[model samples]
Target: MNAVSAEPASAAASDLPAVHVVAAALVDADGRVLLAQRPDGKHLAGYWEFPGGKVEPGETPLQALRREIHEEIGVRVASAEPLIRIPWRYAAKRIVLDVYRVRAFDGVPHSCEGQPLKWVPASALDPSEMPEADHPVIHALVLPRHYLITPQPDADEDAFLARLDAALARGVRLVQLRAKASDDAALRRLAPACLSRVRAAGGQLLINSRSDLVDEFDLDGVHVTAAQLAALDARPVGAKRWFAASCHGPADLRRAQALGADFVVLGSVAQTASHPQQIPLGWSEFAALCDEAAVPVYALGGLVRDDLDAALAAGAQGIAGISAFW
Candidate 1:
């Protein structure tokens, strides 16, 4: 996520030889992404993955990406952006996979190397069929760039709903309803209204530390607090539902990954009214944590829409905030 040098310390630490690879998620106008199957004799034969190959000596990642796309699929990358970086280890190899979203390209994609290729809907791309390293890439491809954490509902519920509707209309696609001050009955009443509005706006709603209500309200997912993350041994939600966690440090992140969390929100990256006394991680520390993270992360606390670029550059999926979002 930091776009650090291709040969970083993490790669050197591994016993296996370091291999740097660049891949492209070629997106079409209809939002489908191109995937190529590994040929019969290659490693992980028949497994599907984003089209790419090893980065040769002296080639920048962008250069390797352009070269790989043309050789594998017969297209020249016209425009692209970084998506995610994965540090992965197989039984006998180590790899640092640098992936990008190919937004614009010159020609239709075909299997130039005689490997099978298909353009599948982003949501339909199954991680189970891909190499383990590409799983996070699928998450990056399908998930939105901005996540909104809802503020506490006020005494006037109508005003809260109106404010939520406006945020949804403004393209806030992923939301977490964090009404911790409300009682169970009040939350039960509010959940449906929030879900209806979120769905109507083509977004997903996750409940804050409330896995039990997810099924009853037909919500999208649950976001667990750090305490809850520590208490759980197994993932609380089904595969179709998202399971996210709030993590403050390395231990929390390790625990969340052990529990197979879909993603995690890591921060207080900046000071905020919600927790003014607490110190922030700042961009440097945040990027350091992200370097070791296997799952997508969101930078929370005091982040505005303008911080999205900074957050992404720091290896985060996006920025999530209560005040700026709501």
Candidate 2:
């Protein structure tokens, strides 16, 4: 749901409607992202995107991602799921973009139709070097590891501190103190204690919902929602500033790039026990998606340490998963 309700005061604001689309976040081995130059005759020619295409009539977003990857690159995608959706307005059209992570597929990729292709590190892309559409995604591509510290509602301050210390000892570089059941007052009281530990351990801290906290705490960055990434016009804060987004797919990738996201987490790669119906895109397809990506991509969804080699081959900078990380 959109939060911006105010009409643009200028006549210039009402000229266009947003375009809706579906995109893929694919990667390959060796920690490099894939990028494809738009063919000479197509829209946004010479620009790049995470490979995949529009969701055709009657097909779901993942289905479209599968079809588009195969059709365009001649590889068969095996599994896939939601990454992020970015609803945006471009110069020529407005779009509601759905993006996905293609996990596995069959066959080596080749441009069935010729277009320029390159694999780059997520850390290397220069927004000024390309089209404007992927700017925010570039920022998102750089976010370092940020672990969410789980604190129970009933835990006492001492116990919470112990958990925080344990996490720091394990070399957690960043943290989000996400305890919803714990009230704001308690969190406030806990913040100083937690931050002291974090800083002593040489870690960065971020209060999940508070940008103000970033300033107040002398911390590193902010964690935002897909809505924030979608609505972002230009980065409102720092350069070399870290911002994380909960994304769904291409539109989200575009928005994240546009807003200058640090990095993003993409979906369940395999069928998890919790989601039997959420079938995953195995591996081949995942690599192809990475092939067209310009920013560092991580493999999310049902991932494990064992999947790292394959994911890297597919072009992800690293792996990101609820189950995979711990």
Candidate 3:
């Protein structure tokens, strides 16, 4: 309901009624997230959304969230952190939804405002049941921020495992094993050691361009190349692996969405040593592409930990990189 409020004070601020809303993803120990139905007679009535409300004149987003959730659902937010901010437009209003992950709370949630509330498993959230502006928020809730695409491992196998360990230690929870130089036989040989390190750290690892190896290795998922993505008519059925795709532009983004990919990697947001000749999509271009994307997009090329906040501000899931992460 608060996706209608937050706007920066600027020359254009007065042009539209800016609704700076703060919302919370109240996650329970079972990994379930809470959703509340807007009471009748309100704007977008009967819509299901994260519990939050309009930010008052002086309250910060965090303050607004705690107050709103307390008032709306009768729970005191104990701990929280920023998640995603979505700028959305309605007919006569514009809203900036400042979403936060409610990691812990003090009391049981009840519909203090007489709204229906439900706790849904994170994996089971259906975007179709949510308001249009909320689809991206669902993606942010489910996917991790940093997506690691491995550089080709050095000939030293032990050294490679160490590198993977370091990346995981640095909090890279999502990984793609994109060893372009290694053939299937070599990748198969490396997989066991690589998987062992990632799995031990509780990170998800997906084989790049090799969906066929998924069951053989009992891996978490697959990342389809653009060529592979173009050839597919539908998401591979019955295998039950998470799927992501490498996407360059709007068309690729559309295809990835149509095929139901969990996410897509987009960019060369800045020039990289790996592709010295390819022009990069400056942040402006990157933001434009991301604005149209239905699925979450991870900005790739020449990005590092420092780029995370800027990437999120530009509407990215996070940054993906070879050298920066390695």
Candidate 4:
């Protein structure tokens, strides 16, 4: 499905009364997640969604999640981890969908509310069949928490391929090959080798160059640079391919959303050797900016695996980096 622009949680949405809701990506041991079809007469009836309900007064989001799960699906949540927080606006109401990944739950999940329940692999969850607010959740479920941006390739092609293989072996499921100095000829030669290795590892590779190369190289997608984001009048790639962008502020984000970018890499969240002169956004500022984003965002700059929890807490899809990843 093509990426759809998200309704930014801006001041206009704030004017509406906010409804706090909790939902779960109830995962089974086989990695399939549970989906509930909205019953007739409900607001979004006939669409499938992550099962959840409104949070009552004084209840923590987790509390509401467990309570709602039991009431709606006849299962007791033994443990749940924060997944994604989505701020969405409808015609008359605004809602914050506090979602969780529930892998440990008691009892089998059956429809307690007479709604139909289905278990499907995360990759099979269709965004069109779900609410717009749940779109990011699907991305979160399908994407890796860590995004790897390759450093410049060495003069020796085999050395570069070996390093790429090593990173893939380390469990990096998503990668961006960003060799700015390489010419098209060099990239054309290197991309296929990278793509073959990444695919063999069951991962996807995105090129940080012209979108056309994605089709030509048979790669997974294109990563739009901030400058490329500004120059674009429309989405550079097709809906079937991943389209990601790099953004530093609100304007770039708006452009990305308008261009239907699947996800975005934002910040200099922390000082890094690559861009030491630039100031870091810190976690607070990063969170503030994330509130304005409609799609999944990966925290960039000077981040490692240890920073994943902080990134997620700040509403990021995960963290991206060059050195730490390579």
Best by lDDT: 1
Candidate with the larger lDDT of 2 and 3: 3
Model 1 stretches with alpha carbons more than 4 Å out: 1-13
Q: Per-residue lDDT for 1-326 in model 2, tens only?
A: 11111221243433665444665556565556666677766655666766666666788766777788888777787776444444444334444555555546687677777876677777677655454545544544444433543444355788878877876787665676655567778867777787899889977776554565666666677666667667667764576556666555666766765566665545555667767887676676565555444445666676676776766566555565444433
Q: Please give, for residues 64-169, the per-residue lDDT of candidate 3 as tens digits.
A: 8899999999999999877766666555567777778897899999999788999999878886677767776787888888888887876787788788899999
| Deviating ranges (above 4 Å) for candidate 3 | 1-23, 28-32, 37-49, 52-71, 74-108, 118-136, 237-240
- Write the residue-wise lDDT of candidate 1 on 71-167 in tens digits: 8899999999988877765544567888899989998888888989988999999877887678788888888888888888977888999999999
Question: Mind sharing the TM-score for model 2?
Answer: 0.51
Native-to-model Cα distance after best TM-score fit, residue 35 in candidate 4, in Å: 0.5
lDDT of predicted model 2: 0.60
lDDT for 193 in candidate 2 is 81
Clashes per candidate, residues 3 or more apart or on different chains: 0, 66, 6, 0
Q: Positional deviation of 26 in candidate 4, in angstroms?
A: 0.5
For all candidates in order, the CA lDDT equals 0.87, 0.60, 0.82, 0.86
lDDT of prediction 1 = 0.87
How should the candidates be ordered by lDDT, best one leading? 1, 4, 3, 2
lDDT of 4 at 268: 89
